[model samples]
Target: MNLSTLTDQIEQRYHTQAEYPWAKFPDYAVFRHQNNRKWFAILMVVEASKIGLLKEEKISVMNVKAKPDEIGSLRMMKGVYPAYHMNKEHWISLNLTEIEEGLLFELLDESFSLTIKKPPQQRLHKIPL
Candidate 1:
């Protein structure tokens, strides 16, 4: 899937809009959780060499948070690479032009779910009696 199609799918499924925070890179868009403001996905055009591609061409890619255990295997798959700007251990960069639509959506969903904040734990305190 391309950037536009992926972003549209994300907006429709996650009810979140893409935010362009960088003035210099207007094309860089971040899709974040509305409640906690945690970023789940970031769409940007980056140098292919940055992601280990032999050619230094600009390519559209999406960085998504991946489960730590799955990162190793995902990186082994085609079109998946170590995250360009995010933490590599828990995130991955996917080539939008190379990945299949179904797998792309599945990864996107996983990233979104990973960013969700868990409820804070309640603590019980004992009062002096």
Candidate 2:
């Protein structure tokens, strides 16, 4: 899927907006959890060769969180690759146009769920006010 379409899907599914937080990197957009503000997905356009493709033409790509155990096998998929600028072990880059929508959204869902901030533990005892 393309950038607008991807962002639209995320907004519809999670009710979160795509944020552009970098001044120097205008083309990059980040999608984060609503409560914790932890990033779940990133959309970027980079030179194809930068991501190891043979050409230098700019292509749209997205980075999403992936399970450590599944990273290697996921990379073997047609459109998934090592993360462009994230921790390689916990993230992956997807060629936006090359991946199927179902698989793409699956990854997006996993990424969002994986970043949810667990609530803090309750206090067992309370002192007098």
Candidate 3:
């Protein structure tokens, strides 16, 4: 699935708008939801490559802190890339190449769920600084 398609699916299912925080980096866009004073379920764009033979790679993968077994079990593929800005051993970079839109959306949902699973820490009471 293409970037637009994948992103569209995410928006539809997640009820969140895509935020392009990295404006200077046009290729990147982050999808997130805000609750109270914090933002969560942040799905950031790491890489995008084209599709087809002569096959410009149009794959986009997100960063994840995968478990040891997850990383250890991932078979290295020819054009596969590891997660960006994430611990290489504990994270994985999923290639969206040749993946169906529905499947991509499902994966994105899983990532979003995992990203937001933990609650934010409570702030300690403090006097004006």
Best by TM-score: 1
TM-score of each: 0.91, 0.89, 0.57
Could you tell me how far off, in angstroms, the CA of residue 126 lies in candidate 1 after the best superposition?
14
**For candidate 1, lDDT tens digit of each residue in 1-129?**
567877788899999999999999999999999999999999999999888899868999999999999999999888899999889999999998788778888999999999999998899898999
Q: Which stretches of candidate 1 lie over 4 Å from their true place?
A: 122-129
Cα error, residue 3 of model 1, in Å, equals 2.1
Candidates' C-alpha lDDT: 0.91, 0.89, 0.53
> What are the runs in model 3 whose C-alpha is more than 4 Å off?
36-59, 64-68, 74-80, 98-103, 117-129
Please write out the lDDT profile of model 2 over residues 43-108, one tens digit for every residue: 999988766888869989999999999999999998898999889999999998688888988999
Q: Candidate 3 clash total?
A: 7
lDDT of 3 by residue, 6-76 (tens): 67866788777767676676766666655431232234443253211253434465443445565555425
Query: Model 2: runs farther than 4 Å from truth?
Result: 121-129
Q: Tell me how candidate 2 scores on lDDT.
A: 0.89
CA RMSD, predictions in order? 2.9, 4.4, 7.7
Pairs clashing in candidate 1?
none
Clashes of each: 0, 0, 7
